[model samples]
Target: MKIEIAEHKKLAHSMELDVRWGDMDAMGHVNNAVYFRYMESVRVEWMRAVGCEPSPKGQGPVIVNAFCNFYRQLEYPARLLLKLYVSDPARTTFETWTTIERLDQPGVLAAAGGATVIWVDFPAQKAVPLPDWMRALVL
Candidate 1:
């Protein structure tokens, strides 16, 4: 499915993270691993916005594949604005898009990327078709 950011109502989601001294390497900026945490925040917020409860039982969307592109640097005590949206859902997977931007500069996007996640049956530990309720929400 294709998600158009312009068509959806803009929702605000943010996560405040403390910059651990260890987060900085020789370059003195947050390590690459931290970006993944930012992405996680966005995903959690997006799930909440769609009124989907996170399945503690693991019978929910599973990240079959994911990737991220970093455009800039982030420092200590940084507040990140995670903008997210859901695209179309396939038989077993759903597409999602996200952008991490600096709250201080609203127009400057720090990173942008997308992911493909598959719905799964935790009991069976296997991929499953998208639920009707999830498809309805995306549409």
Candidate 2:
């Protein structure tokens, strides 16, 4: 399904990454699955930056759902600027959205996507209320 970034979404993070040759498929474009990886990379980076990295013995964010919409083909040898946004913070979950654009062609969307991230207690294998700090950041 296509993910939409709402107008109220807060811009949480952004970063640039190079598209590797290995990310291309037989069609000579970046593989569809690679787009998800691009989204994941930025998500993880943002989480880490906010000191929310998952812990095996503690609580952290877990992606319960994810999606992307490819607007244009992405090719290797390009620098991508991925901007992530967060919104709709609930007791146990929040939403993250990302827009991927090529630096050489600024403001052109190559892909856009996001995930429904729920805070979870790993040891208990269940959802938990978002931490106050996390909620503040997402709000």
Candidate 3:
């Protein structure tokens, strides 16, 4: 979803995450790793929301790359709205971008990240074409 970042529209399957005490680091704010976890969780949630799940035998989504930028610190007792979207779709992979907005702060961009996910045949240990159904949901 494109956040209120200068007119970009938000996707439909966004999610909210409650910041927990354990999620903070020694710096007294949310840790860097926690943001990635949030993106991963939201990606999984997006998959389920669309009623698509990878089979244990083969077809599944794998993130080959990822990164997050911390625009602001997330203190304890915060709620974040996260959204994910797919771009640069290709035969075997797609780029999933995520944004986190601090709801309490209003329009504050807490973080943004993206992961390159490639569909794969686990048993074959190689890349495979993205299923048409999955592509449909992403597009």
Top candidate, metric lDDT: 2
Q: Ranking by TM-score, best first?
A: 2, 3, 1
Candidate 1: C-alpha lDDT? 0.70
Local distance difference test, each candidate: 0.70, 0.93, 0.82
**TM-score versus the correct structure, for each prediction:** 0.78, 0.95, 0.89
Top TM-score hit? 2
Residue 40, candidate 3: Cα error in Å is 0.7
Clashing pairs in 2: none
Model 1 residue 7 CA deviation in Å: 6.0
Instruction: Using lDDT as the measure, name the better of candidate 1 and candidate 3.
Output: 3
**Candidate 1 weakest lDDT stretch, 10 residues:** 1-10
Per-residue C-alpha lDDT of model 2 across residues 1-139, encoded as one tens digit per residue? 2345678999999999999999999999999999999999999999999887688999999999999989999987899999999999999999999999999888888999889999999999999999999999999
Could you tell me the lDDT of residue 69 within candidate 1? 78
Off by over 4 Å in 2: 1-5
For each of the candidates, the C-alpha root-mean-square deviation to the true structure, in angstroms, is 4.2, 2.4, 2.7
Question: Residue-wise lDDT of candidate 3 within 33-116, one digit each (tens)?
Answer: 999999998888988888767787868888899999878888889888888877666899887878898787766688888789
Clashes of each: 1, 0, 1
